[model samples]
Target: MEKKERKRIVLSSNTAFSLYNFRLHLMRTLKEKGYEVITVSPEDGKYSELLKKEFSFFPVKSLDRKGKNPIKDLKLFFEYFLLFRRLKPDIVINFTIKPNIYGSISAGLLGIPSISVITGLGYVFIREIWLTKFVKLLYWLAFRFNRAVVFLNSEDLNTLRNFSKEKSFLIESEGIDIKHFDLTLCKEAKKDEFAFLFVGRLLTDKGICELIKAFESLKKEKPKVKLIIVGSPDEGNPNSVSKGELEKWVKEGLIEWHGFQEDVRPFYCMANCVVLPSYREGIPRVLLEAMAMEKPIITTDAPGCRNVCVDGVNGFLVKPKDVESLYFAMKRMVELGDEKLREFGKAGRRLAEEKYSVEKIVGEYINLIEAVLSKS
Candidate 1:
């Protein structure tokens, strides 16, 4: 009898933080099932250290996350090409815009099967500037060479349908660890003042300004309400909020900014409600975490965000970027009282178990991987 060798899988993303936070479960499962998992991304501060501790981590120095330098992009493409050629992975799975584009192209050039996960359309599509057309063109080229495309929401699939003729699948999200984020884990006593937690990058597209405005208005009527923001400014993103502006809000006692937390479970445990007024997302992980922790939510009725909540069931949905609509939703949540809010949280937990559990999502990925590999 001959010994069988495990297939090698390369997972590339924009940042190591994304790979660790979003795809850790999938990577761990793949390793447990006897596959070599390699992670490729830019070294993202402490997150790179975290990823390095778990699996083989490759730092792509040429990948300028938000830069438009063609020379740097070309270098990144070559870096992926050489890396894939040397490692000779059975397959490559890419996330985020740049990784999807450059990584898929490089993997295709090496005749390795690749899957691009469109985590979210994000800024390029939201702003629709000159770079938007360029990115779309690159996406069309990369996706054409890809074996499959995965979307977190249907809207993103529909939006990019014309870009790729390949088979596309919607996975909802990366999926939350229902057990790890169990409601029972949240043992912290609720504070005297009602606290609303917002977790994500402090970017303009995240509706940070609008959230602040709405909270400012809500605070006048209900002095007991508190807004806690948990995220760091993305310096690479043009839409990122200025530190000065954030400090001004904090100085004014409008928000409690706790930047970049490795563990957000405590914040979730303390929060009365979770809010993410994002303009759009592939699917907000924060919402999933909140749901797993059995916390009520309020989010924009935008693409990815809408998929998480059924209006008036688990939480309230407000119009995207509409300050007044957001304010009203927050006001409604406050008025719902503790009992109704608890009911909402319980409903959210049910939804998380049914739809967004890590077990179910990992099964989907395993199935997809098997099918893709068999055909290849």
Candidate 2:
């Protein structure tokens, strides 16, 4: 019997790392199941090169991740149309904003079906400026012909459902590899240092400002409390805290900054607890990874953030934007005995195994792709 030819699918993202970091496993799975997987993103020499070694890579013209330049976006629209025309992918899988909107719309024009994953609402919904209103309007229009718009949280799903005519699916998360994050604590943590770690892009919307303020306050009382921050400013994010500001924090003895790490397991193992008091999230991956590594988490009670944390069970949930609430949570962590910390860590690992493993997410992706493919 002759083997059936594989269908070609292109994955689109605003940045190359989005795919490299999160979706590489999904790409590999699709390839193993006899699908031709191609990645499309604006070039970053390193991640893009890494992507090529695993699967096909096609670098698109500038997507302008931050700027709202109309001409640039219009040029990008044409570029997507041109790329789709040439590649003739059977299906297009888009992540993040520009690809989710422009890629879907452009691919639709060529009669190719696409799936757009809503990672998060982004600063658009948080700021709620006229620009965001206009962007939501664009999302409404662009998603018109899509197969389905996938949301990791119900809040985002419900928010977009009011404006969109197409079907909405809640997949919950992009997932974390539990085994990869499994840490065998190689070193003993200093008893004097009650290390609190925050891992994510340093953005105002990510609650970096509140975390810093809370840490500074907590440090005044608990002199040994160390704040370890591990991430760089996302220049593409409008809400980003500048490098100078981070340096200032370091100088003030408020934070210990380690710019960015390809592997975050060592950081997770080093900390007593992990924290992310974000304004909102798509089930924050940092929290999941921390859970996998058996570390207690402290995050805001915001939409996606709340899903990972069961207050008084796995970790504490504080009020978003309230520095006082976050400060108190940090205080509580410090006051808790080692046995209580151990209990929180164990429960967190249980949650990670149940909800945030690669195998579980692969199953979800398989189901999603089958459902979409079955439609036609």
Clashing pairs in 1: none
Give stretches of model 1 more than 4 Å off: 188-190
Using all chains and alpha carbons, the TM-scores for the candidates as numbered come to 0.97, 0.97
What is the per-residue lDDT of model 2 for residues 220-274, given as tens digits with 9 covering 90 to 100? 8989889999999998667899999999999998999999888888888789999
Model 2 weakest lDDT span, ten residues long = 183-192
lDDT of 2 at 25: 82
Give Cα-based local distance difference scores for all models. 0.92, 0.89
Best by lDDT: 1
